[model samples]
Target: MRIFAFVGVFASVVSLIGCATGLTRAGSMIRESTDLSVRNRCEFIGTIDESERMGAGQGDNRRGALNRVRNRVAELGGDTFLIVSLDTDNSGAYVQAEVYGCGTVGSSASHAPATPAPSGREGSMTTGSGFYVSRSGHVLTNAHVVEQCREVRIPPTGTAEIVARDDASDLALLKNDIANQPIPAIFRGGRGVQPGAGVVVIGFPLQGIISSGPSVTTGIISSLAGPSNDRRLFQMTAPIHPGSSGGPVLDDAGNVVGVATAKLDPFVVARETGDIPQNISFAVSAGIARAFLDAEGVRYEILPSDPALPTENIATRARQFTLRIECRE
Candidate 1:
């Protein structure tokens, strides 16, 4: 039995070694470039992805992954390639490369790359935040977040479907077939949402720009009304950014009172008022949001309790339902 097991393990390693770098003589001649100038000179052939656990190292088998990709590019008759993305971990690695067929410009020394941007030249990929609204994986976010998105994703659970949206209210509901029953956010009606009440906002702000997850910001309700005295919205002092939209604003009792929607553009405001506004933000009141869900006939959870808890405890509970909302335009 032991001998058979050893033989099986050896065969697997051999197979991995052989698959890691299926380098052809032509593949050896392939060049890698992240320069936009070079990319412009070459025709965009296609994007290729290679995923496998071909090696093990602190570098995460990057060399082996590159060789395999080079082999694929050569096979596709592409002489140059630009890495679009490279993600790896202890289990395996995944690489996305854009193959380009360049003539002679790629050989020029002047086109040598100075640095690599996070990924290859691609379309805009914006990130925001959203929270589960039901056990069946219903999510809530700003309509503008996924407005023009060609594709919408909520990581781990994969792609999500936009169920219902009300542009006027700026709220959109998304549905995902999550593997596990999600712990939805507890919506506290906006009736008792008074100014000076402590609130916690959780979201993924500046997502791809900053390598981080859900962030927590604490503040007090500045006013019962929003810009132009919009009754449907509430004003708050919590700081938020471009990617903070759609995040849940929870009260001290850990019940969601609103959805973080917009932040005052300081630069634009500074130009007009000669003073930049500080922490000026707005959110769709939970009452308005809940009404929308009710109209859509989506079942959600709401608790009547207002048990005061530690801010950290509230954040931890919020994290369970909050997730990064990714949009590829």
Candidate 2:
């Protein structure tokens, strides 16, 4: 009888240790996949699901569900899993993810440097907001800001060379020659963003006439889809002005969740629907932005997820990379 009791206690201890180790490995592997090259190494495996238990709070349940998904991916010999979708029902939270085998790293594609801008200007100055994405001084902003401009200026960095632009997504990439650089914005991958997440926007509003420094606005993600249920865009409650275009819509952890693009025109909408929309702004989702950057062969960094920081700290960190984009058109 004593031998049997000892065997049972030992089995329980071993099981507990195994569970702890699995959780730790899952977290480490997830962080490792944040590297673009590392991510490229992985090939999609299969989709997996994890459901939360009943009687648990929403937040706790969601976390538990995610942990289980990660654990399962690891068990299937996958290094990482990209979140496809998440849903909740009366029973509990459910997570669906695509598994990948990230064993070998892949090489990143390269592109030619941006051409130098000519030393001539002949247009009115229009200012917008942008942020650095790479150590090579690649800046991201709205394509419309520089589409018709003869010269583009990024303060402290002087003139910038337009490298790439996607009119459909309203994203443009610029290169600068400044030696001193700011903190580049980090992006969250896949379906990292969800509705109701806290968000903040930093930009030069009112065409930068209101303040010499960038302004900050705080709100939460109103919806995962945009106007007319557009999947590429997301809606947020953050107030964005004309000059706020091309700015970074950051999460509480200082990760770039989206790019502040446009706000609903109250006049136009009211004329059509006989009603005004308040704080209905739109941002290009970070996942879509990441795809554009990859297609352009732009090197950028990603973070799996960072611990939540104070709003003030997040804004301060963002300002490092955020710059005022002046277009001479």
lDDT of each: 0.71, 0.68
lDDT of 2 by residue, 275-311 (tens): 9779878888898788878887878998865688899
Model 1, TM vs. native: 0.63
lDDT of 2 at 119: 35
Best by lDDT: 1
lDDT of 1 by residue, 94-176 (tens): 78999987642222222422222123434445566899999988999877677656678888788888887776767888898
Which residue pairs clash in candidate 1?
Answer: none
Off by over 4 Å in 2: 1-122, 189-191
